[model samples]
Target: MEETNLYYKLGGQKAIRAVVEEFYRRMLEDELVNEAFRGIDMDRLRNHQTAFLSYALGGPVEYDGRTLREGHKGLNITSEQYERMIRIMNDTLRTFNVADEDRVKIEAFLRSVKPFVVGQ
Candidate 1:
């Protein structure tokens, strides 16, 4: 049987970038989470996120960014903010026609990493 992998199903780097773009666009427009991004350099953030997601999804490229915990340090992110970001990501995946199973896998991956991102 052919193996299933999120990287391939997500169409590799290109698709990952697309999803990140849409996810950020949604987040930037949402008042609830937008405050977290204040004073952040969006372009740099996007590049780091694209690489991180690509690597997380098991794509060909690796993330050259900071470790998740280090990266999120001092951010003071709450569980609600984390869930909001995940919701935006899921919506982006749906917009890209990602299979439901794959979307679920993506979400599961995010949840697994939540501790590194939320709270002190």
Candidate 2:
């Protein structure tokens, strides 16, 4: 049987890196979301995100980054901004041709973390 893990299905580290790169590109281009990333270390953030995504997708990697609330704390992210971020992520996944079922699962995972990420 084909591997059912989302990490494997999405082509592991390489594919997750590609998605994160594209996702950050879109986010940085977006006026609404770009401010949150201002002055942050892109390389470090990218690495953390890659690891985080891998773990989120059930990969072998463990995420050692800050907790969602702690990382986003003091950012004062608005609900609209949070929603926009989700849309961008959905768009990024679609651009990568992720299956609908997989996208749904991913979206659900993201949404499940909304409280921790939004009101930080």
Per-model TM values vs. the true structure: 0.93, 0.95
Q: What are the Cα lDDT values of the candidates?
A: 0.88, 0.92
Candidate 2 stretches with Cα past 4 Å from truth are none
Alpha carbon deviation, residue 25, candidate 1 (Å): 0.4
Cα lDDT tens digits for candidate 2, 15-75:
9999999999999999999999989999999999999999889889877778999999999
* Residue 94 in candidate 1, Cα distance off native in Å: 0.4
Candidate 2 whole-model C-alpha lDDT, 0 to 1 = 0.92
Local error of candidate 2 at 76, Å?
A: 0.9
Model 1: number of backbone collisions:
0
Q: What is the Cα-based TM-score of model 2?
A: 0.95
Q: Which is the leading candidate under TM-score?
A: 2
Candidate 1 clash pair list: none
